[model samples]
Target: MKILNLFFIGLLVSISSLASAQSDAEIEKMIVELHKPTKKISDSIGKLMQETKSKIETEIDSVVKENLKLRSDTLFNAFDDNAINELKQDFVFAKKYPNSLAALKLLRRHVNRFIGMNFYDTYVEVFQNFSPEIRNSEKGKEMAQNLQYFKQSKVGSTAPSFSLVDSNGKTISIDDFKGKQYVLIDFWASWCGPCREELPYIKELYKKYHQQGFEIISVAKDDKQDLWKKAIEKEQIESWRHIFTSEDNKNIIKNYNVNGIPHKVLIDKNGIIIGKWKGSGENNKHDLQQLLKSIFEAE
Candidate 1:
C-alpha cells in the first residue's frame, strides 16, 4: 500500500512540472509578440527624427520649417496614442485572464513608465488581482509598496517634504512654500539635452507667472556642483531655489521616484500636488502650458 501511494505522488509531480514548462513556453511566445510592435515603432521614430533633423537644417524657409515641425509633432502624438492603447489592452488582458505569467512579465517591464505616466492605480488593481502566491512574492511586495508612494505623489496628494541646501547654501523645504506660492519642482540634470531644451520655456513661463506667486525650485541629479552652477549661470537661470544631489540630499531622487530627466511636479498654493509630468516632450509641454494658463485665469 505504501509503494502504491508513493507511485501516485510521483506521477502527480511529473504532470505538474510538465504543465509548468508548457505555461512558461506559452508566455515566452506572448512576450515576443508583445515586443514586436514596440521595437518597430521605436525604430521608425528614430529614422523619422533623423530625417526631420536633416530637413530642419537644409530647408531654411520659415513656413516650410513650421509645417515640418507640425508634422513631426503630430507623428509623435499619434505614436503615443497607439502605444498607450496597446498597453491598456495588455492590462485588460491580464485582468480578464488573471494569473497570467505573461501579463505580470509585461507589467514588470513597463511598470516604471506606467508609474511615470500616472497609471499607478490601474497597475496596482491588476497586479493585486493576480494569484496569491505571485502577489506575495518579493517583487510583488516591492511593487505594492511603490504603488503607495505613487498614490502619495498623485494629483491632489500633499507633496513630500524634504530639506536641502540650495546653490547659495540656503536651506529649503516644502514647508517654506506651503500656503505661500504655486511651486514648480523641476527635476533635471545639467547634462540632459531635453532638460536644457525645455529651460527656455520654463523661463518664459516663470516670467509670466512670477508676479502671480509662481515659483520654480529646480532639482538636479548631478554629481558636480561646479558644472551645475556653470550651467545655471551660462543659461541665465533665475536665481531661484535650486537643489543638487550632494552630501545632504543624495537620495532625493529616490524619494520622489524620479525615473527620468526633465520631470516636473506642480504644487498648488495650498501645498497639494496639482500635476506631474516627465520628459521634455510635447505632452508635458502642453500640460505645463495648460496648468499655467489656468492659474493665469484665476489671477
Candidate 2:
C-alpha cells in the first residue's frame, strides 16, 4: 500500500512541471507576434519622415527660382498693369505666409526698389504683419533698415538726429540746432549741377533770415574735402555751418531720404520738419521761399 501511494505522488509532480514549460513557450510566441507589427510601424514612420523632408526641399527650390524671376529690373520697371499685378501677388503671398522663406526673401530683395517706386506704405504694412521670427531674421532686419527713412523722415515726423564733422574738425549734431533756431538741413554734393545752381538762392535766404532765429546746416556729399572747401569759398557763403558726410557719416544721406542732390529739409525751432524739397527748380525754390517768408515774416 505505501509503494503505490509514493508512485501516484511522483506522477502528479511530473505532470505539473510539463504544464509550466508549455505556458512559458506560449508567452514567448505571443511576444514575437507583437514585435512583428511594431517593426513595420517604425519602418513606415521613417519612410514618411524622409518623404516630408524631400517635399519641403523641393518647395523651397521652386520658391527661390520664382523669386529670381520676379526680382528682374525689367519686371519692376515695366510700371504697367502686369508689373502692378505681379507685385500685388508677391504682397499677397508675403502677407498670407509671413514665415515662409520665399516671402521673407521677396521682401528683403525688393524693399529698396519698392520704396523708390512709391510703394512705401504697402511695404511697411507687409513687414509689420510678419511673425516675430521672420521680422527678427537677418534679412528682415535689413528690410527694416531700408524702410527707416520712409518711416522716420516723413513730413510731420521728427527728423532723425545724427552727428558729423564740420570743416573745422568740430563735431556737429542735428540736435545742436534744436530749441535754439529754425534750421534748414541741406544735402548737397560738389559735383551736383542742380546744387550749384541753388547756391545763390540759399545764400540769399540765409542772409535775409540769419538774424531772425533761422540757421542753415549744409551737409556735403563731396568725395574730396578740397572741392567742398573750394566751393564754399568760391561761393563766399561760409557764414553758416558746413558738415561733410565723411565715410562714417554717409548714413545721414539715407536717413534724410536724399534721393537726389540738392535735397533740403526745413525744421522748426522745436525740431519739427516743416518743409522738404528734393530737386532744384523754380517750383522748389518758390516753395521754400514762400515757406520761410510765412514763418519769419509772420510778425
**RMSD values, in order shown:** 3.0, 23.3
Which pairs in model 2 have colliding backbones?
none
Off by over 4 Å in 2: 1-122, 129-139
Error of 1 at 288 (Å): 1.1
Question: For residues 196-270, could you state the per-residue lDDT of candidate 1 as single tens digits?
Answer: 999988998888888888999999888898899989988889557898887667666766668788889999878
Model 1 whole-model lDDT (C-alpha atoms):
0.79
lDDT of each: 0.79, 0.73
Give lDDT tens digits, candidate 2, residues 182-250. 999988978898798789989999989999988998999899988999999988878988998777888
Best by TM-score: 1
TM-score of each: 0.87, 0.58
Worst 10 residues of 1 by lDDT: 109-118
Poorest lDDT segment (10 consecutive residues) of candidate 2: 72-81
